[model samples]
Target: MLIGELAEQAGTSTRMLRYYEAHGLVRPERTANGYRCYDEAELRVVREIRGLLAVGLGLDDIRPFVACLRAGNPSGDACPDSVAVLRRKLAEVDDYIDQLGAVRRQLQTQLAHAITVRPR
Candidate 1:
């Protein structure tokens, strides 16, 4: 399918697909007429890329994982290095979550104190 159709089917924009290609994430074939053509496999790859991005994975981190996946690894965890990368990402995410939770608690406490101190 063409870029527009692929983007429609994948529930993304064509601009995003082009950005993915530019980032070396998804590679669609070029037709003789110079139109970008994507196969079903590429569509699946695009979905995977989008899913990874949604989880806060940087494009650089996602590239290797995607490459391993395309190389027939079946699972990112199947590759030891990829597993390490995922572990690192998970650790980072955990730390961020902890920090955010702390900040949220602090804000809520401050808000409650302010509410008690002032009538509004």
Candidate 2:
């Protein structure tokens, strides 16, 4: 199929598919007339990539999962590399939550102090 067909099947836009190709995430071949051609399997790959991105995973973090898929695994996260990447991401998320929690507490304390010190 061509890029448009693949995008339709994947429920995404051709522009997004082109972006994926540009980022080295998808490798579509050129047709005789220089049009991009893709296999049907790419539909699944594109969907997987979108899902990962929606969950805050960057393309660099998704590389291992893509590699596992390209290696013929049924699931992209079925490889050790993918597992390691996920673990690292999990830790990062935890740290971010902690940082946000501290910020939230500070904001709450400031609001309380403002209310108490306001003129009647």
Q: Pull out the clashing pairs in model 2.
A: none
- Distance from true location, Cα of 86 in model 2, Å: 1.0
Candidate 1 structure quality by residue, lDDT tens digits, 3-106: 99999999999999999999888898999999999998787788877787888888887877777778877654467766777899989989999999999999
Off by over 4 Å in 1: 101-120
Give the Å shift of residue 63 in candidate 1.
Answer: 0.5
- Listed per candidate, the RMSD to the true structure in angstroms reads 2.8, 1.4
Best by lDDT: 2
Candidate 1 clashing pairs?
none
Give the poorly placed runs of model 2, Cα more than 4 Å off. Answer: none
**Candidate whose TM-score is highest:** 2
Model 1, CA-based lDDT:
0.86
Query: Model 2 lDDT vs. the true structure?
Result: 0.91
- Per model, state how many residue pairs clash: 0, 0
> TM-score of every model?
0.78, 0.90
